[model samples]
Target chain A: MEKAEILGPAGNLSSLKAAVDAGADVVYLGFNDSTNARNFEGLNFTEDDLREGIEYLRGKGKKFYLAINTFPQASNFKDWENSVDKAVTLGADALILANTGVLKYASEKYPTTRLHLSVQASASNYEAINFYKKHFNIKRVILPRVLTTGEIRTISENTDVELEAFILGGLCINIEGRCYLSSYVTGASTNTEGACSPSRFVDFSPTDGGGMTISLNKITLNRLSAGEKSPYPTCCKGRYLTSDGELSYAMEEPESLNALSLIPDLIEAGVSALKIEGRQRTKSYVGTVTGILREAVDSYYVNPASFAVKKEWTEKTRETFEGTSSTLGSYAGK
Target chain B: MRDKMELTLGPILFEWERSEVLDFYKAALTLPVDTVYIGEVVCVKKRSLTIKDIETIGKDLEQAGKKVVLSTLAIVSNEEELELVRELSKLGFSIEANDASALKIAKDAGRTIFAGPHIKTYNKHDAFFLESIGVKNICLPVELPKESIKDIAQNTNLKYEVFAFGKIPLAFSWRCYTERTYGLSKSECAWHCKDHPEGIDLRADTKENGKKAAPIFTINGTSILSGKNLSLLEFTEDLRDTKVDALRISPQYKDTGEVIKIFRDKINGKINYKDSSERLQALIKKPLTNGYYNDKAGMEFLEINDILNV
Candidate 1:
């Protein structure tokens, strides 16, 4: 059986080096702009940083992918085109794109560059994946985190394009590209602006009763008691009051996706790569997650029949999570 | 002297009973809508109307002198949903492609495609690409401003439409919030979404005092909608000038016929903007918002005077 390549997230030069040193076969990073999904402040790479990181990865014989995944608006469409131009010019191993406009430009402008359909495109089915492949000569597609392991197997059987599945990190319960909860509150859009519940609009204030309230654009998302670890205030994870007058996590409880046990199933399902989501995370997090998953994959390949999830791997990944707990997400089924 | 813009009744985004859906379209046939989009665009689990039912409804609407378009599921994850898109595309009605899977299937079947708002046509380049693939009309995403719509219109000759009214669809999740709120799992949902014909109102407490809670979002099965309705009745003049081809109004549970009439009257110059705006405000239960049209938050409401001035 062919081993699935372990793909890691790299926010900057340090995270890139950390992921490479921790045995990630491929590391993906984005420009410090709205072109990528992780367009947060002080995150992602500068042009100089991209050049230096590419050189370092080339030296280490590791591959790097560039994400220009966000949908481009009419006003700044050129910026996306420029990012595509720059990424290909920098000798990126692959370019991950979400918008059809960007895909058309990249495919026509640079016909030789490898293109992976971003999860933001929300192409969850094989037909959609094949559509991208047929139109742009897309080489791979990152499946959304909404499919079951069985469904992934069925899709793999149908499409000839390579499939990449998310193995770890922040879990978006909503379909990525279709969601507009962030833009409904803040004017910024995750689709167009690549910012979801942007940190600038998020405010944390202490309550009178020694609790803290997290608000996005002055709308109270959740109120945490003192000493409670608050998850990042994305609209989907927030607790709200239903019409029944009960306050609950009506959408989803704050949680991260940990697919450690499903490594064998995903590989058998024909996933060519396993992606660890989170370009906004620190280098320490990038290193720890990449290292743990690397060990799990290696152990599974060496002796598939004897492979079992080590408790220490799960515990170590839990430490770097934003949510209090982790789940297998949609992989195991609802 | 541009031609009068048409009004399209978008597909039902909520889970209504079979009889209710049939009755809704039966009434829609008498309304002033030029085109009627019928089919399920939300959760596939809520199968109140089957493919046969949709075909019957489409036949009835077309016989009533209305162009009928069938919409596909917004998120096609499984084979069951993909088969539905294929089946609908072959049904011979015009197809509204909500996802790339549907878009490709419908186009391959030689069905004229209407790119739904979820297809992400943000720029003229995106619109041009869709047009190249044989999409006849494009319903711009709800987040775009008037300027962006005009920008796309200026660059492309394809027919353009904007979501003008109803609870704007905001997000979708794999887990059914309706079931989760009622303390049930998605697998055992038992069709609980039919209980709330509109949707469950999700409210948040006000910042001024924790005593009052304002409606923030509407939890409809797996999808989320804005708590308030979006009305562009006051901005018909602005829309007319943008050279848009049509205005889409998502069918709500109540007063849909009246809403369609009001838009028709406003578009035909029978009712002025103020009277039509007031009439719509009185009909809707929640507040009205046109913030997205002005390039602000989707939930924020811009007053009539403020919108016109801009």
Candidate 2:
């Protein structure tokens, strides 16, 4: 069996260092700007941080991937182009991008640099993935969190381009590249603006019934009883009245994507890399996930027949799972 | 003068009965709009219409003096659906591809293709790439601000279209929200989507004494759209000021001819922007929103006066 890369997310210098130490084959991070999806405060790297981080990774014999993944508006075109130029100048290994325009520009201007399609592009099937690969020379596609493990196996068989599957993190119920629920509520689009459930527009108020009602831009997203864990108020997970007029979790229950149990199957299906999806997380998260996945991958390869998933593996990672709920997501959906 | 700008009716995102669709387009064929797009672009499982029904409707709509276009699914999952895409491309009209998979197949078939908004072409480079690959016309995404549309239109030679009316398509998913909401499996559900012709509205509860629950989203099968409809009636002239070739009207479950007429009159300068917008507003049930055109939240409604000065 070929070795699969354990890719980790780096929110800052500490997380980058932690990933390297924890056995990350490659670390993907973003600069401190709206171009990155996790454009949160006190997160992401500065120019100097990126420069030194690249040096540190090079010295350690690991790779750095720049995530200039947000879609650029016409007014922000120059900024996206400049970031592509900067990534190459800094000796970054590859760029994970979403916008079709940005991909075309990078493929034309810097032909040698590797371009990985971001999950935001939502290329689920072989033909869509091949379209990106054929037109832009995209080297890899980070599959959306909406496919089954069997589906991934079929797609890998059809396409020669590399496939990067999300192993663990906050799972988006709606496909990442197409969703605009956050933009409707807060004027921040995941596709165009790179902010979904932007924290700035969220407001909390004490309900008269003794629970708290969470609202985004004044529309109550959810009302939680005291001690009820408040999951991220994504529009898809929110309870809505159905056509039969019943209010329930209309799309999905709030959960985290944890593929630790399917590591052997995913690898056997020909995934070239496993991606850990949290650039907004703390260093502890980056370190812990990288370590667990590293161990799991190594053990599975060292003795494929003897390898079994230990309960402790999921228990350790479930500490950070969303709403204390974990799922294989569309990879194992009903 | 630029030849009277075309008004095209986009594919219906709802799952309507065959009779309802045929009658709706029967009326739509005589409307002020110059083109009528006929096909099922949403769930392939919604078999309310057969290949024969589509063929008859396509022939009837063409005979009724409207240019007909067949649209492909926004997301293709299996080989059967890909085969369906090729079948649609072979039909005697231009193909409107909502997914790149369909785009590639259409290009291979040497069909005249129009790119759908789901392609997410944001700038001149992407638009030019679409043109390079045999797309004759491209509908810009619903979430794009006006400046992006203006830039792409000005910089590219490809004909462009904007969502002039109806609910904005926000996302597409394989899991059906309606089936899950009803606690029924995908195969077991008894066509509940037909009940919600305009889609089920999702509202946010409010604590304010005088406020109503704000309708935030509408789910019609696999496509999730804005609860409020998007209208560019107030800015038809402004859109025309740019290089935009046409304004696309995504059909709601209403008598669309009246809405299409309002847009045509507004574009022809027969009615003032305010009066036409007021009339158009009176026809649709949902609150009107045009925030995306002005770089605000998509569910927001801003006036021409407010966005023009910016």
Poorest lDDT segment (10 consecutive residues) of candidate 2 chain A: A239-248
lDDT of 1 by residue, B208-251 (tens): 46455668899998899998888888888788788788999999
Following a full C-alpha superposition, what root-mean-square deviation does model 2 have from the true structure?
A: 2.1
Model 1 agreement with the true structure over A183-289: per-residue lDDT tens digits? 88998899988879899999999998889999999898989987777578988888888777788888888889999999989988889899998898999999999
Error of 2 at B202 (Å): 0.7
Instruction: Assess candidate 2 and give its TM-score to the true structure.
Output: 0.95
Candidate 1 clashes between residue pairs 3 or more apart in a chain or in different chains:
none
Collision pairs in model 2: none
* Poorest 10 consecutive residues by lDDT, candidate 1 chain B: B205-214
What is the Cα-based TM-score of model 1? 0.98
lDDT of each structure?
0.90, 0.83
